[model samples]
Target: MDQWIKTILEEFGAIGVGALMLLENVFPPIPSELVMPWAGYSVSQGKSSFLAIVSAGSAGSFAGAWAWFWFARRIGKERLANWVDAHGAWLTITRDDIERVDHWFNDWGAAAVLLCRMIPGLRTLISVPAGFANMPPEKFSVYTGIGTVAWTALLAAVGLWLGKNYGDLARPLSWVSTAVIACLFSIWVYRLVQQRRTGSPHKVR
Candidate 1:
């Protein structure tokens, strides 16, 4: 992952950061925790601008989230519930569970959307339920942008801080990325096992 991200950032600059964010949302395992910090590191090296990187990341997040939102919108709740009923056990999702989520969305509306964007695994998944519940696109975009920009900024700030003393850690990042990935993977495995055993859909990790 480090090598792939490094190659892209080296080759593509701020655009690469945007692409990485897009990929992270489309493929959740990629993780913004890894990508965003690297972006901040790049900014520290003067390879990219802070505003540019943040904007790119936020845009990528919104685009990916929007795709899922549209998909859920197209599927509609009835169809989704049918799919969830027929196939959700393996996935550990239940019809009632989905409704519970929908009700939550109904009550909280855009605020729930905003809060969920800051969460790690739920960030993208929440968009689906929001869309399933027929959230207004304009309202969704505004809150989504708000939460995404704030979260991405926090990640970039971490990277910038690390960059302040990056000289000694020149060779440490490979292992750092590896360690981060490994931890996330382990957490995912644990959750999958738990989900399968319990026959309930919980968070991915």
Candidate 2:
């Protein structure tokens, strides 16, 4: 993976960093923790500047987020609610739950989207709720951009600090990413079971 990342960074420069970060948002398995820091390390190697990498990465993340946002908008709330009603048991969600979530997102979406963008597992998923709530694109972009930039800068700084030791941290970072995903899945499973047993949606809100 390191070789692949290095190859991409070497071949495409800042564009590769943006592409990787875009993919990282669209596909959760591609951890931004590794991507941004690695890009930072590349900066250390004179492959690119820190600002360029961070800007590109932030742009890519915003694009990926917008993709999901538009997708939810395309589906529309009525259609999504109907599907949830049909598959609520398996999904452990209900139409009422969807409405509740929509309301919650409407109320706190700005903060939620901003804060979640800095979180490992929740970052990508947060965009979905924002979309479902029909958040204004301009507002969503503002908050998402602010958070994404901050997160990207922080990760890139880590890479710069790691410097020659970046390789040493790769494995540990991968483990951390895997653990976060596992923990999120575990929580979902627990919620599913609880909802199933009680015949009620488990409210995380």
Candidate 3:
């Protein structure tokens, strides 16, 4: 997968960065951790400019997040809530879990959108809550843009700093990614155990 990502960035330049970011946002399994840094390393190698890679990556992430927000908006809150209530267990997310996010969005508004884009797991899922809350598209764009640019720039910069050493650091970065995934899995397990002990507010159908 790492080699595949590197090849795309090598062959397609900034466009490949944008495309990968879009897919990453829509499908959370695609790691931006890998994409942004690789693109940055490419820039260091003079394959592309810093501004172009960052801009394309940010644009792609924004578009992918918008896609989810738009879809959730079309679904509407009640129907989505009902679906979640029935089947959220498989995803380890309940309607109540969603409602907590909704409340957090209500409390934090645009800040919530901006900050979440930088978070690994929350980056993509945050869009759904925003959609459910019917946050104005323009507002979403402003915050999401700010957040994605900051995030893309940060990761790309890390790669740029690493330069030729980026290859050496790849294994360490993979381990970090693995640790992140493990932590997320642990959180899910904790949630599941808690749910069993206390019972969910809404019974899964």
Which structure is stronger by lDDT: 1 or 3? 3
Question: What's the lDDT for all of these models?
Answer: 0.83, 0.80, 0.85
Best candidate (score: lDDT)? 3
Backbone clashes (count) for model 2? 0
* Model 2 Cα lDDT, one tens digit per residue, 55-128: 99999998998898888888987787777766666555667766765676678769988988898866786787
Superposed model 3: Cα runs more than 4 Å off:
164-205
Q: For model 2, give the 10-residue run with minimal summed lDDT.
A: 196-205
Ten residues in a row with the worst lDDT in model 3? 165-174
* Per-residue alpha-carbon lDDT of candidate 1 for residues 1-205, written as tens digits (9 for 90 to 100): 8878877877898788889899888988788988888888888888888899999999998899998899999998878877877776555556776777788778988899899899987788788888887889999899999999999999988887788776434356668889989998787677568777876553322
- Taking all chains together, the TM-score of candidate 1 against the true structure is 0.84
lDDT of 1: 0.83
Which scores higher on TM-score, 1 or 3? 1
Error of 2 at 69 (Å): 1.2
State the lDDT at 113 in candidate 2.
88
